[model samples]
Target: MDSFSHAFIIAIPLLLAGNAVLVPFAVIGAVIPDIDGVFFLFPDDEPSRYIFTHGGITHSIAGASLLSLVAFIGLYLLSGISWFSRFFPEGVTMMAGLAILAGAMLHILIDYLAYPGIPLFWPFSTEKFTLGIFPGPSLMILILSLGLLTLILTGRAGVRHYKTYLILCLVIFFIYAGIALYANTETEGRAIPTMDPTRWITIVETDECFVVRPYDILYGRGEEISYRKYTNITPDELAGIARLPQVQRLCYHSYIVTAERRGDTVILRDPLREEKVFRYPLDHSSLVIPLQETRSGPLPKNTDRP
Candidate 1:
């Protein structure tokens, strides 16, 4: 889950718990798991470091629990000091604890529905559990948007208390997510017109940008391309790629290309960067007609000889 969803989960609970004053802080704590995104700000030496995956430490149950404990202890301890004690107030210590716990639990809950599951019981166990609620890229945005809107409308119009709103929103989120998941399952084997894996090019159309990913080898159409939250290539790999005349001339402006490993060799391709895109893997071997005639036709072929 991204920051917006994270905030929604946490804030909804806190608001419902009658901790409206702490909603903003709860939102901030919920987003702590995504601090890995800060890696994008600095330049790296190789492509491997560029967000290999998300939801490792911060999205773990340990992280969320630690956040709850910190909020509880820090405020409790600070309550002793007069100048730093206003946040705790007189009768709100229990409310604050409940708020923190609610926020932390909600954070983990939202992440469970994402592709790479969060460690719901980290330190105790490191297993990842995913509900696979939505596909990467476009489907995620659609799902999250619907969830957020439902939460807002139902919470505001129907519920009188924050707790009621929180439960209602969670209910709506799960129901809507279930429907979206069913829809994605239905489309798994369906043909997507613009995407053909046999061709060297991958097309990603969004509201803001249209991305095209191309295979740069002498004759290799990129294999098994999927839309993912994190990219395999780091800033260093992107810079190295930019120096290549073939990539610069053909792909730099169209798509953001990167390399990932299969067995030993690294294959070049464009990744589905955001959670708002869809991936379609084309099977070139299944094609009866030449690839050059369709939408993403005339792709480069793998020419490395044995």
Candidate 2:
């Protein structure tokens, strides 16, 4: 979700409650999860380069909790100083921390529905929980939110107007997202009969890699394909690569959790990026990765699905 959508969506409730001091903190925390992107700006050769992969730890519940605690301490200390006291009300720091926590939690929950889902419960379980329903952001939602924001910030009436617009925005978002999620969920795992013979999901899996075939689903049968993971590498090879922190980080973001053998390279890709598999021109997300260079080997066979 865009920062504004989350900010207005989360902040309005606090505004309506007559605790507008928390609104700024709520908006601040909402965008904090994306700070992981900063790691990509600077260069690092070691595995630490992947230390803060976008949507890795910072998007997790634990990460959010830590940030909330940080916000609490920092703000509370600032409020203690006489210089900052004029701007901050008594107990505002504590309330701001709670607002931060609430906003961040909402951010994570919304992102969990997007493709190649977030590691919300990582360290405990690597399982990616995703609805893969909407595109994760709706322009409609943003527009409605901005309109309601105008109403909340400047209006003829006071609390009554703010409350109405706030409720309206929340209701509209829930209804819009709920419907899309429901539709996608209904279509997700099953292959529904169709007049078209278009392929839905096609993966060529072997003892090694799963080469996800490129196909469109909108024009044809709505079938879902699932696969199991296997690797041709021996225990020794697996152990060596597993030790590399970068490889572990790559695997962490990968939903497919499988590897392929490229030309003298060990390739691992998140199956969710299947559309990029056989593109004539490889894009970044498409040309996902080759874990580490190794012995060149025969490629996997083509296993077409019915």
- Name the top TM-score candidate: 2
Query: After best superposition, candidate 2 residue 155: deviation in angstroms?
Result: 6.8
lDDT of 2 by residue, 1-306 (tens): 666777766777777777777788888778778777676676645653443556667877888778777877887778788888777665655567888889899888877755445667755744445554334455666676677667656764466655766677667557655654444344433121111223233344455444443334445333434444534544345443553445555554443455544545555545554544222112122223344533333322111111
The local distance difference test score of each candidate is 0.46, 0.56
Error of 2 at 304 (Å): 24
TM-score of 2: 0.66
TM-score of 1: 0.45
The residue-by-residue lDDT of candidate 1 on 90-121, one tens digit each, is 53366666666666677676666544345555
Steric collisions counted per model: 13, 0
- What TM-score, computed on C-alpha atoms, does each candidate reach? 0.45, 0.66
Task: Kindly give the stretch of ten consecutive residues in candidate 2 with the minimal lDDT sum.
Answer: 297-306
